[model samples]
Target: MLAQNVKKLIDDKAMDLNSQGDLADYVSKKITILNDYIEGKRELSEPNVDDILSEIVGFFTTSLDIPLEEGTKFLRARTYKVNHLEVNVPKLSYIPLDLSELATLGRLNKEKEPVYYGCIYFEEKGGVNVAFSESNAEVSDNVNILRSTAKCDVNVNYVGIYDYVHRQCKPRFMPQSMFEYFEAVSKYQEEKFSESVFLAHLLCDAFLSDILRRKKSGNLYRVTSILFSIYTESSDIDGIMYTSVKSEGDPVVALKTESVNSKLVHKSCDNYRIINDYGYAKYHAIHTHYGSISGNSVSWLKKNT
Candidate 1:
């Protein structure tokens, strides 16, 4: 169910900004095109439609700015489960790490300004309830059941679970405000909404209501640098865990890095550049936002900060 909801949001963006009502219309068009391409009926890539898809992903990340405060807050509320997160999942909580070992990652790009979305370690879990995705070729990039691409078009990367949600779990159509108003109504009677219901409203606001609010109030934006904190731990769980407020604009996210130890922000487009203290290389990673991985970057950050 969660996967379906996410997919709807991603697919809807293929048609328009973030309206759930518009998702089917956009997806229908994408599927039709993909079918034509698969049957040798059309070209490989459509020109402009992909941009729309990227925009929709951005809207889901909670990074997109909606003008009205209610809309902004609503979008923030829905884009992710940042709630009860700190209480139940200690790992989900944002922690500041010492980049004194900054050379381990790379030379910080001291020039660029960074947008801050708190961090979480990216981890790879095993023996989980689900398995990973197959490949990007099996599904339409625009709908992105698996895989993603950036730069406004061309879906690339790991299979996205959100696309499943879009295809299977979209809400019945209604005006954005009206839909949420009903939520208020249910709560007004002191009704206890289920966890799923709460998440539904959060996601609904992120993809639908929030974008509408941005369109109306002039709060929409394009982003550049994205910041995330990578964490590491000792023992059996070996790898890295990276977390941040994930956004899905087709932008490449020219990376601007921040650290608790280093006061300055580093913005770098060169993913391969390495920084060494006393000519010794330690650790380095290519930067991306809302991305997933296994384990933490370098132990618990909470100890120092």
Candidate 2:
């Protein structure tokens, strides 16, 4: 389905040949130096990091323009919840983080930059909900959490990362746009597409090596956050979609706070209280609520469940 989506994007817009030659020149020259550095043929020197990042940003900008559905749902889990007794009270639990709350670097946002991070439903393998994994929430007899779900109320363009997992990872998705970019470059330069593809994969592995690591160290997020900043520089993109590291490559999204506040509607939320055995986890729904947006506030209705 993803490959077909890319094909449809290609069909809808004719490839602009104007930048093809320049893109080809840049990749061909950079790939050789990158390979030399990997092979220890030359001592590691600081290659132009911004130039490489720019090429990546340029590739996505030129290649695809897939828009997400208006009804797409995003699931966000919280270790805490709103403590209120009223049935129709305003709540901030289902909204994006406040500016003061967003003081650290996240998977895609820089320090102090507000972003709405959520796990999306994966249709492959019947269905998979990655919210728990993405939130790093583990429930047992002693642990429980609240989950807030929101629906996209407007069509938004989110830039997607093609399959980036190791080949050993299961269920590799189709049509990696990185290789496609290099292949297009190869076409203009009359270079072997396979060779360019090999270099492209090597580049991905080199640059994104720390992307899937489980550690939440601040330094690890520096590169990805920079990439996202570059991608959104045009203002045409509202967010980014990438594989969730904690969920074994399940799709996840990070939308700018402005985009989320303007385009997403709070749908519902559930409080799961675990009451099972110590080694096992079972969710007991303590409460459920349906949310309605008003002006800048969200009012909730107690749902009997």
Candidate 3:
């Protein structure tokens, strides 16, 4: 189905000479990569389908001067029921990338982009509901489907919550926390270890605060304890801490346990701690250098979470 969708995307678009040539080149390279993988001559990692599609879309929209809406007509439309409301929202389907598949590709000599796709459905009926994608890649048209419809008074109170989560639920950690984390990483990459360590400690503190807010734990000591427990108990602390707890039952427990057991979570926490304690001043160091988190760590977080 996905392959067909991709092919449809390719066929539907009218292309100029340059665009056609680029498309042919891209497809030919991709096919060669796949063939090599099949014959065991080389290992091919799955490319991110959405990203590749988005790049193709970009070629049409930017290079060919095609309207954005016209360029994204090939994406599969999916209908989702808004919780507590009788509205059915239509959206483009997103596929999930699997880490195990990426790990398999990582073992190969050459770099391969993992191309797994899956959609996350909202099972619960209420609260601030927000759908997000990992990539900010311009894969889909930004034209609003709801613009033509009359605005209904569904739940005004939930609007603020939705907005908050929308901005916070970034690719990795919340945007601000992710920024700080990356800044620490950048410092480390620059060989400014002390500054990197300080920023890392700060990042950990920010992360803890976010967790406490989500958990609704206001007491500082309790927050600290919960954060510590989360770091210690779960391998995927971010997943465990970030996953919405819609209902209290086996489902939540199962999800929490699975996230906690993830190796990525363990590594993230371990790195956080390592950076936190690496500096001479445990909590008060002020650093000028900025660092970005390593790509491997970022990939791990994205995959595991």
Model 2 TM-score relative to the real fold: 0.58
| Cα TM-score of candidate 3 | 0.18
Q: Candidate 1, residues 186-273: lDDT per residue as tens digits?
A: 2421233333332443443333322221211111221110112111111221111111112221111112222211221111110111
Q: Which model scores highest in lDDT?
A: 2
lDDT of 3 at 226: 25
lDDT agreement of model 3 with the native: 0.23
The total number of steric clashes, by the backbone 3 Å criterion, in model 2 comes to 0
What's the TM-score of every candidate structure?
0.20, 0.58, 0.18
In Å, residue 298's CA in model 2 sits off its true spot by 4.9
Cα error, residue 257 of model 3, in Å, equals 6.7
Steric collisions counted per model: 45, 0, 18
